[model samples]
Target: KMSKEKIDLLKLMGANVILTRSDVSRGHPDYYLDMAERLSQQRGLFYTNQFANNANIEAHYRTTGPELWQQTEGRINAFVCGVGTGGTLTGVGRYLKEQSPDIEMVLADPEGSLLADKVNGLSAKLPGSWLVEGIGEDFVPDNCDLSIADHAFTVSDQDAFMYTQALFSRELILAGTSTGVLLTAALRYCQQQTEPKVVVTLACDTGYRYLSKAFNHQWLERHHLTGDLEGL
Candidate 1:
């Protein structure tokens, strides 16, 4: 689900906003992606099927991957990220591997997502629900190249929210729920390493967009996140 602020901001930018069911699976008629496709067809509008779009992968591969390589001076040992449509994973992962095959491509997945298990070579499991939005998927999108993932980690909503809060309080960096999952996985990967290494993870979006969810104390309490904040 998207945050209220984001939805409002989109409307403020003059984009027509449409609400869809958050409870539906990918194949369901009410699923956001399916609904978007149906609406686009009915209205004779061009639909950007990001999940299967080569342009999505190519943009990240040509721009984001090269930028990271240049900014880091080619010393990066790992690239950590969450998979939404899979563009970033496949594109960046492919680019990084081409530059250096030793660079690790790490996957940070939400607790309820099947992506982590899929990376670990496990059989498909029924998808579960999570509080975090955008990153995790019930079904793996074609754009995502899971083969690039050398390691994977699953993060709970409690851990994601708590660490995201800490990122702001301690480091003064405002990040989103999905960023929390990436941060958690990156930290774990760093901690388990035997030697010093360069690691990279995404901030994704700002916390200002999630003020009513991850940044709300009352909402955190209601979701049982209050207790786990200290544990993290």
Candidate 2:
């Protein structure tokens, strides 16, 4: 589900890219994460495993969380985020909670991901598929801390893409699909509020790389998203 522009950029940076099956889960040999780990061992390469890496969480705790607090002047009331490596959620959630325990930590999970239900205390179900890249997982990574979340929202691919297009048209913010998931859940959280609150979310990626997929009308049509996205 990654964009061609991103792949091209990686190639341009002199990285040997390996394309893996996107449909598989973590344990499958063909899964991207598993393949990367296996290949790294064989090649004797240092694999910075983001899922289990403490540095991933620490980076956000020291940098992103503090930056948000500083930029918002500590008036921020809630944080909305999608889970990928879970670094951002756990790290930022910990930092913000330390500053103010009342600050809500919300999860914006893709529809096919198990995280939303997991956070909301629902019974487990088999994980499905989603088109948005770089976020969501069939299983929670070691870096993820679901207890940090106060609420969770599941975002479908159709709604995410539609809102993402609307964001560009209405606000001129070219965000990636994952950002769409955040936007959808963030807006929902804002709407349900009985009092005014300063909500925070990240425009985690640039939409430029998604030109042929999330940003492409033809691609949407082919995927049967056009009909659903109409009038957005």
Candidate 3:
């Protein structure tokens, strides 16, 4: 983790600061950049290159897409992903489209996100509040190519959380919030197609990071999302 002392030193040395908050945690690169720009202007300084380029984020997404294609023997016809900083969705979507022009890139946005509206050629509105993290957006990112997405699904936070728990209990693959959205979208897409089509969705991150938030029953009950775990 980055330390506050180092951050303060960097700021003292004229480094443009980009402070990320929970409000933009599930938003896109454009949202973070715009926030940074506003802060910089208020402080009478220029803030450029305000984008997330974490190696961990890039590596995971890049690896997942290629692994899926290889495991499915290039038969994957559709992919569903949730957009966070547009890294995973943009990188994987671009790669899959380049390999197969007809492949459908589906975006799984939270119910109140602007992404679904933007992809469907509708005017985007300010997003409503949601419990899900690391997916959905109040604004779109510059790197995200809406044209590459053939369809979009607006999933609810409750469904996303419930299915995420199901994934852990059934498949033993503990995935985070964004993955829940993707899985829900992927199932929906698969059921709609009559033909035998291989579809892929990401397990964006491990559920360990969300234990305190999503996996805890106490937290769920606090949010009025309590349910039977036996079926999960």
Task: Give the number of colliding residue pairs in candidate 2.
Answer: 0
The clash number for model 3 is 0
**Cα lDDT over the full model 3:** 0.75
Candidate 2 lowest-lDDT run of ten: 223-232
Worst 10 residues of 3 by lDDT: 48-57
- TM-score of every model? 0.96, 0.96, 0.74
**Predicted candidate 2 versus true structure: per-residue lDDT over 1-232, tens digit per residue:** 7789999999999989889887787789999888888888876587899999999999999999999999999999999998999999999999999999999999999998999999999999999999988888899999999999999999999988888888888899998989999999999999999999999999989999788898899999888765443465
lDDT of 3 at 180: 83
The lDDT of each candidate is 0.92, 0.91, 0.75
TM-score pick, better of 2 and 3: 2
Instruction: Name the candidate, 1 or 3, with the larger lDDT value.
Output: 1
lDDT of 1 at 114: 95
lDDT of candidate 2? 0.91
Which ranges in model 2 have alpha carbons more than 4 Å from their true place? 227-232
* Alpha-carbon runs more than 4 Å astray in model 1: 228-231
